[model samples]
Target chain A: MDNFEQFFTENRLKLDVEPLPEGFNNQMIANFRAVRRKKQTIRLFAAAGFLLLLVPGIMLLQPFFKPEPVALQESPSSAELSILTRLQPYQTEIESSTQFISQQRVPTEYSVQFQDFLIQLQIIDRQQDIYQKQIDSYGYTEDMIQQIMYNYELKLMVLQKLQTEILKINKLSKTTNHEYTNIQLEI
Target chain B: MLGNRQDAEDVLQDAMIQAYTNLKSLKSVESFGPWMKRIVINQCLHFIRGRLNFADLQLVNTPGESDETDYYQFSMEELNSTIQQLPDGCRIVFNLYLLENYSHKEVAEMLGISESTSKSQYQRARQLLQHQLKKKMNHG
Candidate 1:
C-alpha cells in the first residue's frame, strides 16, 4: 500500500471510531431539536418586532380613518376681532356693488363686472380674515396682526388700482367715438 | 497554537453551532465534516484575515509533533486523534481516501481542488506516517 494509505489505515485503527458515546445519537437528536426550536424562537421575535414597528403606523392611519374627536378651544382675541373688522369694509363694498349690479341688470344670470370685482374683493378679505384669526384666536400677538394687515393692505391697494383702471376705460369708451369691441355680454 | 486555546475552542464551538444551525440545508449527511471544516476555516480566516501575514505558508509543514509509535502498536483511538491532528487539507484528503474510500479525482471534485493537489496531499500524508513508523521501529 502507498505510505498515505498505510498511515491512513494505521491512524484509522488508532481511532476508536465508536458510534459516538452511549445515547450520543439521542443527545445529538435532542440538540438538533433545540437548534430548530431556537431558530423558531428567533423568527417569532422578528415577527413580533416587525409588528411593533407597525404600531405607530397603524396609529397614524387610525387618525385618518376614524379620527378622534378634537375639542376646539374658544380663545378669540383682539387680533381675530381686528381681522373681522378689517374684512367688514370689503364685505360691505362687495355686497353693495353686487346689489347695484343686480338692480342695473335685472334678470341676468351674472353681471360679469360685478361678479369679478366682488369675487376678487371677497378672496382678499377672506385671506386677511384668515390671517387675522390665526393671530387672535390662535394666540398670535398684536405685532403679528399688524404684519399680516400690512401685507393685506398692500394687496387691497393693488386690486383697487386695477378696478379704477377698468372704470376709466369704461368711461372713456362711452364718451369717445370708440365702442368696446370685445364687450360680448352673454347675459 | 496561533492564539489562546480558549479562543480557538470558542471558535470551534461556534462553528459546530453554525453547522447544526444550518444542518437542514445540508443535503448530504456524509459531507458534514467538510462543511464543518469550511465553517471553521472561514471563522479562522475571519479572525486573522489581514492581521496574519502568511509569508511561508506554502513551506509550512503538517504537524509532525512526535516520532513515536509503530502503526499496529497504536490503539485505534490514538491513530484517529493523530489523523485529526493533521493539517486541515491533509486530514480531509486522508479521511476521504482511507476511511470513505473516495478516489483522488472524486476528492478533487468534492473539494474544488486539482487532482494533482489531492494526489500530492495523499502522498505527503503517506511519507509522514512512514517516517513516524520508522522512528518507532528504531526506538524499539
Candidate 2:
C-alpha cells in the first residue's frame, strides 16, 4: 500500500500540464454561446415546420383538433377510400392529358384517333339520351316497342366499337393500369 | 515547434470552433473533452505534418535545470510532445484513460471498440511511454 501510495504521488507530481493563457475561459464561453445560437436556429426551423403543418387546419372545424390515435384500430377502409373523397387521381389524369396534348410539337395520327374516340363517345351519349326519353314517354307498357325502336343489335355493335376505341386510346396514352404497375415496379 | 504561442492559439481556437459547430452531431457529450482534444490534436498534427522527422524528436531532450525543478513535472510542452509521439489509436486511448479517467468499458463504448481492446491499448500506451522515458534518461 505504501509502495502504491508513493507511486501515485510520483505519478501526480510528474503529471505536467500548462495553464491555458488568460482569456481561454472567455474563448470557451464564446464557443458555448455560439452553440446556443446554433441550437436556437435549429429550434426556430423546427418550430416553423411544426407551424406549417397547422396551416391546413387554420380554417377547419375545431373537431379536427382532437388528439391523434394512441392505438391502432383495425379497419378495412383505412387509406384506400381517401382517393374517393377528392377527385385527386382523376384530376391528375386530366392535367397530365392536357399537358401531353398541348406539349406535342407535331400532330400525329394518334391525335386524330383520340379526337374520333371523343366524337364517338359524344354520339353514344346523345343516343342514350334519346333512348331514355323514349322509355320515359312509353311508360312500363312499351318495353318491347322501346327495345325494338332502339335496335339493341346495332347499339351493342356501336357499344363494342366504342369499347375497342377507348382501349386503343388508353394504350396510346401509355397510361394504362398495366403501364402504371410497370412504372411502379421500375421505381 | 508550431512557430509561436499565437499560432498555437489560433489553431486551438479554430479547432474549438469546429468542435462547437459539430457538437450536435456528437452522440456522447460525456466524452466531449477527448472529442475536442482530438480536433485540436489533428490540427496540430496537420500543422507540423511534413516538417517532422526523427531529428525533430531530439529537441524533446531539454534537460532538467534542477533536481527539484518543475520541469520534471507535467509540462504542457513535454506532455503535448509525448502525446504527439504516440500512434493515433494509442494517443486517443491514452488521453481518454489518463486525463479523462475513463474506465476501459467507457472508453470502449466511446471509441466503438471492445473493452478488451481498450484495456490492451491502455497497457500498450503505458509500456510505450515507459520505454520512451527510459530511452530519454539513458540518452541524457
Computed on alpha carbons, the lDDT of every model, listed in order, comes to: 0.57, 0.53
TM-score of chain B of each: 0.49, 0.51
Model 2, residue pairs in steric clash: A15-B74, A16-B74, A16-B75
Query: Which ten-residue region of model 2 chain B has the weakest summed lDDT?
Result: B57-66
lDDT of 1 at A85: 83
> lDDT tens digits, residues B27-136, model 1?
66456556655676556545544454432122334454443333666656545555555555665565666766678898677655677777777656655555655655
The candidate 2 chain A region of ten consecutive residues with least summed lDDT is: A178-187
User: Candidate 1 has what TM-score?
Assistant: 0.40
In angstroms and one decimal each, the interface RMSD of every candidate reads: 6.0, 7.4
Over 4 Å off, model 1: A1-20, A45-63, A66-187, B1-11, B27-70, B77-92, B99-102, B109-113
Cα lDDT, model 2, residue B74: 41
If you assessed candidate 2 against the hidden native complex, which CAPRI class would it receive? incorrect
Query: In angstroms, how far off is B97's CA in candidate 2?
Result: 0.5
Give DockQ for candidates 1 onward, in order.
0.27, 0.06
Best by lDDT: 1
Please, what are the lDDT tens digits per residue for candidate 2 over residues B68-115? 213244454554566557765655566666655667787677655677
